[model samples]
Target: MTGEDILYPPRASAFSWRIFKTGEIHTVSVGRRKFSADFQLVFRLIKGLIFLTFISILVTMIALPHMTIQDIVVCILAFMPTGWGMLQIAQALKPLVRRAGFWGSVKTLARGYEIVMGLLLFTPVAFLAWFPFVSEFQTRMLFNQAFSRGLQISRILGGQRKGRSSRNKE
Candidate 1:
């Protein structure tokens, strides 16, 4: 056995098997090592839930002539976690933002622009919300692209690429 293998025995590899809480700090155990982070796994799940809620609400709003009081309340509640998750994700990415230098600053500014646009949607000036909304939406899409690019780079650097399937290769 390699010295590294002796130092760290093989452990469960599936991150999906674990449950994480939203409020508190927790440790993720990997073989003999542990990691702690400000944003827990639960927030990631919450973010996904938020996205689903958004799509559902949009569809429902479009389908219905008018929304009931209950529908409004539910929509508000569903949207709360989206704002929370966005803040948490931004907080979690602070270190990476610092490490990325100039491009990071641009991303940070884009995030700020998104927040500003979100706030503008609530103001009397919201008549122009469409303009800012497009900018905010584009910023988010680009930011997501950058994040995925970073992940791909990290995977390549770490030697963890899964080879293409036969169909994909062809």
Candidate 2:
């Protein structure tokens, strides 16, 4: 046993095991010690739910002839903040993506493409000042860690709009 291992012993908790079983905890091996990363588990779960919601909406729009172009436009506009939020989340998780290998790289590129398309589709809404606020709120509710990381990225990127702040700002 190494001195480092003795100083920082690993404890296998029931909660960690449960999360592991759900496939959210990824075990990363460094030397002989294995570590489970539970950091982005909540964020992944929330993203999965949001993706399913988007898919369902797309199916509904395709199946219903009654859904007009205006309705589609409105939906796109409404989801702009969400797209932006996802972008921020993606940025925050870039390090993890690098470690995730080829498929992760492909997914990141796909997400970038989708964000660009959405911005083009709703160019006017993309300039709105309220998007950051909404995105922050969504991030806070879903994953606090991502929220903080996103804020740091936003600060570094600059160009944030000044307006009425959300209640959750600290």
Candidate 3:
């Protein structure tokens, strides 16, 4: 391999849908580079905490009789991405199940359970996304990393332009 290749490895790329400000959804390429183990752990921990928080809020909204329609709608919008993310974790773990030993067999059963749960979780969201705005919002939430990366690139380019402008004025 060349020195440049060794120094700067190629980033992983995946295709995902992105929602534009004008309410158009389009499939776009996104980076999927590996994160540090520590970062992964912390990110998973934070995600779990956020999921729990949303679940609690949802339960409260259901249990209270004084909930407004707006509150219900807001809760649903917030909860979809949280639930989708958790199900995604379950889907990710399915392939890791082993089936050779007793524990492996147990894990296989657990994997089956996870698959069932993932289907259950996905069904409602799949239906909900049939609506245009809901689908746009869901896509925006799920592919947020792509949007953030775009913003970062813009900021860097903007800074470079400003630097050139200042140098030209000097």
Candidate 4:
């Protein structure tokens, strides 16, 4: 052990932290040790493959008016992740909120719920109400990829998708 080692900590993580341009909470690193030489390249590869599939579906849905039943199911399956990610973040923050004496955790979760769900629902509401409707396949595929990949930690921290977004009226 050298005296120099005490001040400069060696990088411990296996992955590199990719900073968000928006300065969101930086979910990519969990706000911890950001750089790592070790990484699960296999998992990364798999994630990428899955994401590509998702994108394919989304494009197809937007291009086609009628979607297959599979497309609809895929879309719903995809959104499952978004819901799961939001729930996980809210759950994680519950303890912090209570400890801070800001409010009850339940209240925090509820408030978060309203905002997250709203944001998530924006695309659906708009697609249903206005604009050319994407095929059920594409819609489902978009959500499928999103949910399957999970939300980035930064998103939770930044309070992104906090509420439904307004769509441009076409």
Give the candidate number with the greatest TM-score.
2
Preferred candidate (TM-score higher): 2 or 3 = 2
Residues 1-170 of candidate 4 have per-residue lDDT tens digits of: 76544532222100111111111222222222232334556445544655675567456654553445664565455544544565566568877755864334334445555776788789677766565455565677777766666755557756644443323332
TM, every model: 0.21, 0.27, 0.26, 0.21
lDDT of each: 0.47, 0.50, 0.49, 0.47
Candidate 1 lDDT over 1-170, as tens digits, reads 76644543322111111112211111112211222254556656555665675567446553553445565455445444554564467567777745753333334434655776688566745555568786787677878876766757667755543444544677
Which 10 consecutive residues of model 2 have the lowest summed lDDT?
A: 25-34
Q: Write the per-residue lDDT of candidate 2 for residues 1-170, one digit (tens) a residue.
A: 87644543333122222333223212212211222255456555555765675567556644553445665565555555554555467677877756764334335445655877888778865565367887766657888875667667676545344232333364
Residue 60's lDDT in candidate 1: 59
Candidate 4 wrong stretches, greater than 4 Å: 1-39, 66-170
Task: Look at candidate 3 and tell me the lDDT of residue 132.
Answer: 96
Give the RMSD in angstroms, all C-alphas superposed, for model 3. 25.3
Candidate 3: residue pairs that collide: none
